[model samples]
Target: MASSPNIFGKAQADVLAETGTALLQIKNSRRLTLEDMARVLGRTDDMVAKYIAGEAEMGFVAFRRASEAWPELTEKLNGGAE
Candidate 1:
């Protein structure tokens, strides 16, 4: 049987957790609901919620757009090094 992919490992997991926390914080600070974020990203609320919950992986394009649009997000959440 083929082994399943390890979704969460060391580095990636840490980044995902940090990103999720940051997204949540930003959402709370802006009084934006998951639906709001979904609208902004042109995605479904369920997808945004999944990303915030760390249940879904964010693609590089989406991540880059978000980081560019909300620099504070990466700074506050990802340690501001990127």
Candidate 2:
């Protein structure tokens, strides 16, 4: 069987990469290593690295879980929502 078309364009991929970079910065600012983040998200260190490198898309649940692990980023992530 043939593969499906690419729904996400280069621009979108770029944006995701940028977001991943930003998230990586946030994690760093918190003094958390990739292994620490992996433990928090119940993922492997490689998976965390991939997510931060924008090689993989982080689902909403993982994002939310990450925010929970670092409560400070939650407000900023959700636009100050409660």
Candidate 3:
């Protein structure tokens, strides 16, 4: 029988943490304030802060948009995964 892939594991947690950190780094490198990231992501500053703080995981759609918009940073965060 076919088996489902494990979606919740250390690897997933690592990916989330890495992605969150990379997002924050990108913002810093670009000299973008939290408000700037919020504007780019169409989210509130509080939400962007939460994302940067790793208090909230971005939904797949938002992640996709971010990945598309910032491929370099996303690639680093996602371990080069598309």
* Candidate lDDT values, in order: 0.75, 0.72, 0.73
Give a tens-digit lDDT track for model 2, residues 11-47: 6566457657766777778888888888888888898
Q: lDDT by residue for model 3 over 34-63, one digit each (tens)?
A: 888777787888988888777777887777
What ordering of candidates by TM-score runs from best to worst? Answer: 1, 3, 2
The ten-residue window of minimal lDDT in model 3 covers 3-12
TM-score for each model:
0.74, 0.66, 0.73
- Ranking by lDDT, best first? 1, 3, 2
Tell me the lDDT of candidate 1: 0.75
The candidate maximizing lDDT is 1
**Model 2: residues >4 Å from true position, as ranges?**
1-10, 71-82
Candidate 2 — number of clashing residue pairs?
0
**Which pairs of residues have clashing backbones in candidate 3?**
none
lDDT per residue as tens, model 1, 1-82:
9544544444666667777888888888788888878777767899888888887888877777667757688688646643
How many clashing pairs per prediction, in order? Answer: 0, 0, 0
